[model samples]
Target: MSRRPHQIAILGTGYVGLGTAALLAHLGHHVTGIDVDVCKIEQLQRAEIPIYEPGLEKLLLSNTSQLTWTTDFSAVQQADTIFICVGTPPSADGTPDLQFLQTAVASLAPYLGRKQQIIVNKSTVPIGTGDLVVRLLEDLAPEFDASVHYVVSNPEFLREGSALEDSLYPDRIVLGGLDTALDHMISVYAPLIEQSFTPPASAPRPERYTRPAVVRTTLQSAEMIKYAANAFLALKVSFANEIAGLCEHVGADIEEVTTGIGLDSRIGHRFLQAGLGWGGSCFGKDTQGLISAGREHAYAMPILQAAIDVNARQRQMVINKLLRHLRTMKGKRIGVLGMAFKPNTDDLRDAPAYTLIQRLAELGAVVTAHDPVAMARAEREWSHLKYSSAVNAAQVFQRADAVIIATEWDEYRQLDWEALVATMRRPLIIDSRNLLRHPLTAQVEQVGRELKGTIGAAL
Candidate 1:
């Protein structure tokens, strides 16, 4: 059944909100991207995207006829569905601080009852928050209770670099609400659920991708799903790192071991990277939040606690490697290639590169780093450090004692490594991500590569 286009209001213009707005508008919905940040709103209005998400600018700019950017809360009055996409940063105790979510809901309460609409929580909030939202909204505006508007929990599963692609063909569209509100929610995502809409020119549908499954469950379950999923992924990476540590002593290669085990159907190869550990906004925050939430019930999660511990140790391991190569680094110049947590993004939230660089600088090492897109953001954060930010990767190796491959950017993979190594004072590389191509003539120390085998000698 074909339904008329819904007026969707996405609150907060962060990565999740912006990606959702672009995807919804492309799927024939009239989307209003709202935010409290005046500068962000003005930037969007001026055809400028504050963040670096691939295909987002092209999608929004191409489909400008169906999108609106504003700072007005009154836009909710016409919205058939309102999404709260605010950030819920982690507090000191590792629990999610929901101050942003609370404020967004408070501002949205008065605007209800213009018509019956579905208020969806797309933010990654704590479990049972759906019930809390209902009660809070009832207290704020008693007139607009469950009868006037329905509250739904729809947690986001979008990744940072691949947000648009993930939203377009999600693994699953989880809807957590009562029966009355679910039909409306289904209608809003029918194009995606049924795989009916033609693919965008920039983001094409995969060759063998089937229709995405719609998971119907209770509100609390949906919230739990998001946290559990992220935690599991973090555990997987940590597990690989732990095993890699053992592999080093047992004279086994981690890359070959992971490749052999990943061939099993039950253990498909995905997050088995034994690099400088996982980073960005989701993994650590979500894992720690789940562990903290468990503590509230007087429960202990030793597995999760260990996962977090292993991750921190990974960053420290970089320093251990540095000391092994450059003994007594009271005065040494170290070059770092790739600063962003991962490739295809400029997000530096809890990035391993930041942690590694900080440790290197504290040990009296003169640090110089290079990243394709993250230099400007990193400069603002690391201005106090005695460091130089290089525009290109080659400039970083000038008179440097050693270079660390912190991030696995594609541009770094295709670099003329032989040429770059000639400029460095010490032709040594700590390829943490295992990214450098083979057929090397320089000394390279990878995370899991056997210690005895010389990668063609002479650093």
Candidate 2:
């Protein structure tokens, strides 16, 4: 590890920006997190985290001396490396809207110093976005020497729940840039690339990991890597759900089938669990961006398109299962088990639970939801639905006719099923996530298959 720390500025305080800021600070770099949201900046200035990510707050607090939070863009002038971590949300046509990226670049143009600096894109963006950024910067700062400024695409692959660990012990660090920008980007992540930094106390180094490999490639290929990786994972999940649907029709247990197929060396099990389809800030948008990018090039990405279709169908499958069990959802109280996309984070962007709740509401099913961490955000976002505290899961069960396990939180798996069954009016457990064992009820329906015959029959 280099004894001299690089001055780093991270744009945007969302998951990727804040996590990267904290992790870099923890790695002994002087980091300044810049965001346009005044409230978010204020919150971070007060040592408060606006988002829920495990170990993030502690990491921020522990490295407060090395980290700075502000809405000031001037910080970029002093930084040796600037990371653009702003959101590239999907537009109406499913293309990544680079408005934020463009705005960030334009704002930083005037402050770009004559000294050589690397501007890295840490956001998941379209393949040609790096070229776009370079052009935009050139147009914005024609007076500034172009040779001193370099644009690089270093897309992030951080998962929300375990973002800190993922950033610290990543599978790989991908840098897409010309040779001129490569050395600065590599130096910025040298600690992580070489595994020389001490792991944060909150998230220790994992036993099954080694130093992450660094893959240096052209800007376009590196951009495609981010999209392709996410699209492939989404495909795996949708494929699993498709198989689960077949398992139900043929009376085959999805668990057994997945287990058997997962044992195959080539088809190792990771995203093979059939459940409510993927939702978060990344998968859906990145997949959509990839599809839209292909369309622009007159190329067809049928596999990626089908993956999106299958994911949407999986949510509908859950709805169909509910309708089959209740005959009609009209006036029935359905207790939704989780609201967030997945466990350990409060992010509800594109969560499958939102789709299910909307459909259930249209069917006149009164929805009551619960999540260990996302209930407050859910309440703020979807005020029409009812929410129960985590401690009041039994209360929700008692009031509802059926319980739907939407998000597979670890706490949901450890729920007192017997107590919940006793409380439910109908004792119907719709395990969309397939996270539960055989409940003590005859009316247990899951995504893969349903146990309709007996209470303790094959699950």
Best by lDDT: 1
Instruction: List, residue by residue over 1-459, the lDDT tens digit for candidate 2.
Output: 355799999999998898999989988899999989999999988899999999999999999999999888999889989999999999999999899999999988878888988889998899889999889888886445768888898988888898988999999989988887887777778888888898878889999888998899999999999999999899889899899888888999887888999999999888898878899888899999999998999999999999999999988988888888889999998888888998889998899998988888888888777888887787788776543344456666876788888888887766677766777778788888877665465477887765444344223
The C-alpha stretches of model 1 lying farther than 4 A from their native spots are 381-386, 451-459
lDDT score of residue 249 within candidate 2: 87
TM-score of each: 0.96, 0.95
Clashing residue pairs found in predicted model 2: none
Shift of residue 408 alpha carbon in model 1, Å: 0.5
Model 1 — which ten-residue stretch has the worst lDDT?
450-459
Query: What local lDDT score does residue 42 receive in model 1, on the 0 to 100 scale?
Result: 98
Query: How do the residues 295-401 of candidate 1 rate in per-residue lDDT, one tens digit apiece?
Result: 99999999999999999999888888889988956789899898888888888888998887888878889888999888998888767666789979999888888
